[model samples]
Target: MPPYPYLATDYDGAAAHAAIFMVQWKREGDSLARYLVRIGEMTESLKIIQQALEGVPGGPYEYFEMRRFEGLKDPEWNGFEYRFISKKPSPTFELSKEELYMRVEAPKGELVIFL
Candidate 1:
């Protein structure tokens, strides 16, 4: 809220404190998933940001675990990308709660735990 974004660390004091933007974005491709986080720049014509993550899909499952966060600037673009690898890849099955957690009666008249 101080007109900038700050990254906190577990060591003790804040780690990265710099002019940052509120809007961040995420992107994923065949071999790379990345995030663009604005760190500094005056306008869209002079954009500067950090590539918060750029790696294969099976890389670290946490943001902080990403190793190479590089700085990039583009005078004609505005974007941000980041990924919090979820506990599971987006469930392609897209099953509803009722489908995932259900109780069933067995053929022999027994209750089955189908959660």
Candidate 2:
């Protein structure tokens, strides 16, 4: 379920809240992307956020989010990629984990914003 802020007693309020989430999400995401790149760290957060919003493997809404923080060091990425998929969506629990390609390739972008 979406957060409580998205709940509304009327259609107008619901639309207003949806708009609010869009605006606030962009504003906050930009600011956070900047902050994460501060202190000389090579950053590419916009891409990551896009990756999360796009969802993973199961397609679009299948996965709820994908995130990474400062950890590990590989030539491609100096962090850990977290792909979060909700089991409730497809409910294909019978399949083995290997049957599902859990990891997802992230999006690419070059935008920055900071608080």
Q: Which candidate's lDDT is highest?
A: 1
Q: Residue by residue across 17-87, what tens digits does model 1's lDDT show?
A: 33244443345442323322332223421322332222112435655323323232432122231233122
lDDT of each structure? 0.34, 0.33
* Candidate 1 error regions (>4 Å): 11-19, 23-50, 54-115
For residues 5-48, write the lDDT of model 2, one tens digit per residue.
33334654211222112211233557676665452232333433
| Residue 85 miss distance in model 2 (angstroms) | 20
Instruction: Note the residue pairs that clash in candidate 2.
Output: none
Q: How many backbone clashes does candidate 2 have?
A: 0
Candidate 1 — what's its lDDT?
0.34
Error of 2 at 5 (Å): 20
| TM-score leader | 2
